[model samples]
Target: MQTGNLLPLVLALAVLAYGLAYMRSRAVAAPLGGIRHLKSLPFYYAARASLWCGLPALIVLALWVAFEGKVIQGLVVSSLPSDLMPESEGQASLILSQISNVAAGKLDPQFVPPEIAQAGSLLENLRNQSQTFKAVLVLLVAVLGAAFAWSRVAPNINARESVETTLRRIFFVCAAVAVLTTVGIVFSVIFETIRFFGMVSFWDFVFGTSWSPQTALRADQVGADGSFGMIPLFTGTLLISAIALLVAVPVGLLSAIYLSEYASKRIRATVKPALELLAGVPTVVYGFFAALTVAPFIRDLAEAIGLEASSQSALAAGLVMGIMIIPFVSSLSDDVINAVPQNLRDGSLAMGATQSETMKNVIFPAALPGIMGGILLAASRAIGETMIVVMAAGLAANLTANPLESVTTVTVQIVTLLVGDQEFDSAKTLAAFALGMMLFVVTLLLNVLALKIVRKYREQYD
Candidate 1:
């Protein structure tokens, strides 16, 4: 009876109707008819009938769910006594909730006046009416769809081909939706970054040496000039990512080699998921570990070695990030290496090459394309990592290669720029978008290059 509950009831009825239609279609025609009677089978007819009966009703239910709250609120606001209505938006929402509760008989009558009571009754009636209308509409659509499907169903209808074509279209639409969503996100980042560039010169942001971002809030305030140099941030990002890759690539790649080429199946089944546990660990936890454990350890080691090291060193953050990326590289690379044909390894072995030799010379070369793909993917992840850098790497944007010094990364800068208070139109907030766009472009390029390399190598192996 309630509008909130109508969608589920309608879906249930639609499913029930589909089941009945399917049964009727099947009863009328056996799955395999005499050689002259059918093109495909009876189940295909049932499936077609069921899909037609249920899909349209489900679509309508989805639309009603998406917009019903807005429609109900508009109706309620138009019917309300202006004097009794709450002034603030927050208060209005609370009032609406109270009114809904009253209509549902969940609220006491003493809290509401006679006029409010009449309004509650009207709301209840409206809700019931709306639900009835939706259910009837859905039922009518389902019946119409079923009737159309039934009319099309005959001894000679190519139901299998029709179902396959429909399914293919659905899958293609899903793929398009996914691709469009990614493109939309990239465009949004680009547009906002362009707005930011309009406020700050592209050359200054990219090439300037200084990195301060604090600025005065008002136009009349003095000393509001903010520096927006990105060179230092980008340098820091590269340094950290390089260090992480250095740490992760060797360990990850070797582990992948062992798993793919040498480890027993029993060992692999146990070790693979255990290694994936590294990926599952929260970045925030890694952040604290880097800040508390790794940073201090690096600082102490630097002091012992007669070198000055900042407590919050870029090395510490990068090291932890590397550990974090290991599973990503190892898991992906292992799978790629395993996918290489066994014949390549066997051919080398048959020529009196040792197992290690075959793995190193034959399997490794054959799998290089996929391995590069994994490393590129891992590099992109390292570039995008945020939490560990924010917590461990100091905010100062230093353009030095010395890993012991405090430094910042693009992701860290973005977090610092947007964290607390921000005006959407300010250069400071907009800079985050620019940084994001740069990051996106870099990752996209890496992926494209990796794919190209993989494809070329794959052709050679084939």
Candidate 2:
């Protein structure tokens, strides 16, 4: 078997071994003696043993899987006859691939030399021996570790407490991993953005009035001067988000109000799922719907009103994006609205307030923070949306407020910048990372602010 295909078998064996060890440990320690029982259960001991035995071996196996081919190929190439070495790296890779296939008893149609066959046989034997040795070593280590751990289990052991502590530590480690991953992603974006800034001044990137990323690569290339203005992209993003919020907020809020306050059990059950279905529809489908259906409709309507509209316009994209985000706003807002104390509504009713007055004056004010939090979340989603904008919004970065005009967003710019074959180090390519960092920072700030507002408001209600 190929090295790549062996990893799953190795992982499956390790997992199976862990399960068996756990069950064995449980069975061995079942009878609890008076006042001498373990502080932790037998299962905890088993799990701990399994973790120690399996985790390290699995990590090594993964690393080996990732780099084993490269290491082995390098060794093989270095040992190859000088005349057999291909002149081009591409050709060398092809030869190596053929060698691998031949080693697995798959004949290469292009080059079936006798020497190649011999080399393949030798490599296959080495691979098989290496795999067997590794598997045996791992099995021996795991079994020994489990046995040693089982031997240590005693009546005085605090197995339950130890297990609880271990689990807590594991949860904390998992949390740390999530946080570190986010930090790592942010820093990676920041580093690349800094590189982009080095090529173009920070002010030019931020406030320049024109954005023409298409620049000359060669000195002789004329008409190569490109503008780095981001004003248009920012404006387009805001415009689309605004249109979406306008479409979504009222409809979503009203739907939330009806669902939470007035809808019967049957209606609530049917309507909630239907609304959620909107969220499940893929964004790519929305993109085509915007481009094929919504854009054309908007253009025809504009013509009827004696106004001009492009086939691909901000209004169409924004409208579709808004429709997409309705669930986000409505679902969250509904929950928050429902969370408002029933006693407040009861008191308002007793004081002769109408339902509308109570909702408008008391419930809404109380739920405003949470509602704002939901809106901010929706806005963040709209900002990051790509496919719909790429399809419906034109690529032109026009810094105009007219919804009928074609415009682009930061996301669109990022997509365009990185779409084709790209050199990672180029200013154009790195600009995507800079835009990403900015988008991340903006979204992060909005989330933090929204959370703060929600917390303060929640404290007031408490």
Candidate 3:
């Protein structure tokens, strides 16, 4: 059976096991007077039975799914005649793809080699047998596990402790999976980045100002001495992000302050939702707005003031991105300001301080950590924005600090580098991983700074 179909079957069996176990527990208790005499409630016994029925079966299914393809492919390859066997990994992959296409009816059998047709037939037969065995074995295991757990349930059994222990271990495993997934991603990016650096000098990539990354097909080819310098991309990213922050922070912060501190309850209820609606708008819609509306407006305004500007400029993208992240800042800051202890505000006011003084001295400081967190989040959003920039700011990678010029960001370059059918070993493709590694490092540093600020402010308040 397919994994999706098997999952529902397993869950149905678990539910059946739970119901049976609950009835059994009640019957055993009724003979011994009542469930009060039992060590744990009937719910625990049913839960334990459900866990036994589901957990082992799910684990086996997972392991089978994980290794199924490799094991099947190995068997099929081994069965192939020596003369027809692949000599390299790439050849093997091509053979597998052909076989898969034939098996799936995507390729005509008469067009393929006789060996490939035979292999496709073998693959289909083996897959059928594998699914049949998998379904039978999983169901058998589920039944056996449920029976064992049902036999163990009695008046004196501590089913609560057993269930709790199992749940605790499951939670720990989930946390471990999350951590290990992160570690795996980091290592994979690092490995690709190392390969990228082997092709391009680290200094040239980091410090050089040129940004062209098209590699030459031949050494004699003209206009393809690819420069992989990342400075221009970073410069554009920071310029746009700075513009976004300059636009977002004051407006968002002031809106938050007014909403939390001065607005009536009804007004807060109505206005906050309307304000936060900006966050729900699709980024692609924002991109369209940036391209069709904001860019033209900025260009017209700059021309009116006798300033030079590109039709697609960073300012247009940054302004729209700032508008997009406004809710992220205002909502978080407003919540943090509201969470400040009311006594501090009252104490400042009691000392003959005005409303603004109390707000500045008592409330803002108390909420500074959270407010900084909001700003950091908005900054990250702005830095990571792609659609808005791609739409409003042309992908020129201009190393200029001017917001009125066309430029591209690291993220835009990364997307450009990996957009099509590209070989992974090429510097052009691997550069994406290097860029990702740098972006990850930059975000990590921001997170660390945010943490330090939160800790410092938390210590002061505590």
Provide the TM-score for each candidate, comma-separated.
0.83, 0.84, 0.96
Candidate 2, residues 45-163: lDDT per residue as tens digits?
A: 66666565565565666675677667767766766677787789878878787778898867763467665666676677767766776666655665665556556566556556655
lDDT of 1: 0.84
Model 2 clash count equals: 9
| TM-score of candidate 1 against the unseen true structure | 0.83
Residue 91 lDDT in candidate 3: 93
Better of 1 and 2 by lDDT: 1
lDDT of 1 at 122: 73
- Per-residue lDDT tens digits for candidate 1, residues 36-90, read 4666565676667767777787788778768877887778766778787778987
Sliding window of 10 residues with minimal summed lDDT for model 2: 33-42
Q: Which residue runs of candidate 2 sit more than 4 Å off their true CA positions?
A: 1-36, 49-53, 66-70, 80-130, 341-352
Candidate 2 overall lDDT versus native: 0.81
User: lDDT scores for all predictions?
Assistant: 0.84, 0.81, 0.93
Off by over 4 Å in 3: 349-352
Clashing pairs in 1: none
**Cα deviation in Å at residue 441, candidate 2?**
3.0
